[model samples]
Target: MIPVPTGARVWLATGYTDMRRGFPWLALQVQEVLRKGPLSGHLFVFRGRRSDLVKMIWHDGQGACLFTKRLERGRFIWPSVAGEAVTISPAQLSYLLSGIDWRNPARKPASDAGRIAAFTV
Candidate 1:
């Protein structure tokens, strides 16, 4: 999940689905969806019913890029399924997408130069 640009909104789809299955039928027609625009440049995020797998689709001028990730031991930290679309900061999205414990309150201590040097050896 990436942050939508300022003044720009992302239409995130929570349900996991075969994006290809829907893109061909729904990409061109955008009247009923959350954000209506040409599918060529927008970010589309999808998750499985279990919230374990995530897939993203985007078009970067020249071609489309697809990204997918599956967790080995846990599920993706998904937002509450209350609204069709929600605004999120770039930092929150990054943490959620990276499989980090976003809900944890404790922060990991930053490693000092001594620790870094030890690892380099």
Candidate 2:
């Protein structure tokens, strides 16, 4: 579970079960919750009922931060609607935002470093 620093307002939407069953309407959901509430300067998270589509919206005073992620191989595990909010680790968020596979890991070598040998071996 990722702990958002205290004093930062974080709202998680884990209503996937209900959302799926109710045929969640994105426009209506955003309007009713995001538009009406003090969403400004707050972090909002949403997950698709079936797919691995996770959407996040946040207002950082200057502008809104919108984040979305889709897993290419496997579907992300979603929380039960009965739960209050699913906790995500900061590391997980970073990986998800960067389009890196959090499940399967790989790293690329640095390409900017100069060659070690002055002349070709």
Candidate 3:
């Protein structure tokens, strides 16, 4: 998980963005298109047109950071609202990154008789 500041807010840019854009251009979009300060310490996330990739930009006071993620199977869920941006919590971002439905996460059963779960590094 990202070490986001406790008070920092996350904003999802509505619609899709060009994934080829770098930090400077994305920062410009955050300023001119979203009407938000790129250096405000808030994190701004943008999804690619294909919906499988996402780009994030944040100013961590000391320097600018650009993060990108691509799903191996499912596409990242997005809002269809006709707005410039939407605000979400850091927890929701984590859920979204994990390919889960951040909008309404369903409960899973505690007992898994047929399946086995394991983690390896």
Candidate 4:
């Protein structure tokens, strides 16, 4: 996981994004469409049209960093397109990267009762 600063905010861009574009274009999108400064030290996340790919951009004061992730089995969970963007906690970003449902992250039942018992000991 990237080490986000203590007060840094994560912003998710609503709708699909063209993954082909790099950080330069994405930074432009954040400034023009989202109406936020790209270099404001906040993380901006974008999901591709296919929903399997996700890209994130952040300006960490000294430089700009771009990160991307692709899921082999499932798509990344994204918010409905009700607005230009939505802010999520860093913990939710971790869940989103893991291809888990960030909205409702309930624990799943253990696959083996014995395994659970063994770990509890």
Worst 10 residues of 2 by lDDT: 17-26
Report lDDT per candidate. 0.57, 0.54, 0.92, 0.93
TM-score of candidate 1 versus the correct structure, residues matched by position: 0.61
Q: For all candidates, what are the clash counts?
A: 1, 0, 0, 0
If scored against the real structure, what TM-score would every candidate get?
0.61, 0.48, 0.89, 0.90
TM-score, candidate 2, is 0.48
Question: Taking the tens digit of each residue's C-alpha lDDT, what string does model 4 give over 40-111?
Answer: 999999999999999999999999999999999989889987458999999999999999999999898767
Off by over 4 Å in 3: 110-121
Worst 10 residues of 3 by lDDT: 105-114
All models, RMSD in angstroms:
4.7, 7.7, 3.8, 3.6
- Model 3's TM-score against the true structure: 0.89
TM-score-based ranking, best first? 4, 3, 1, 2
**Clash pairs, model 4 backbone:** none
Residue-level lDDT for 58 in candidate 2: 58
Please give the range of 10 consecutive residues that has the lowest summed lDDT in model 4.
112-121
Candidate 4 lDDT at 76 equals 89
11-110 in candidate 2: lDDT tens per residue?
A: 5566662233221343335556445233445555677776467776655656555656666766655445544554455565556445565545478776
Tell how far residue 6 is off in model 3, in angstroms.
Answer: 1.5
Model 4, which residues run further than 4 Å from truth? 113-121
For candidate 3, lDDT tens digit of each residue in 38-62?
Answer: 9999999999998999999999999
lDDT head-to-head 3 vs 4, winner:
4
Model 2 Cα RMSD, 1 decimal: 7.7
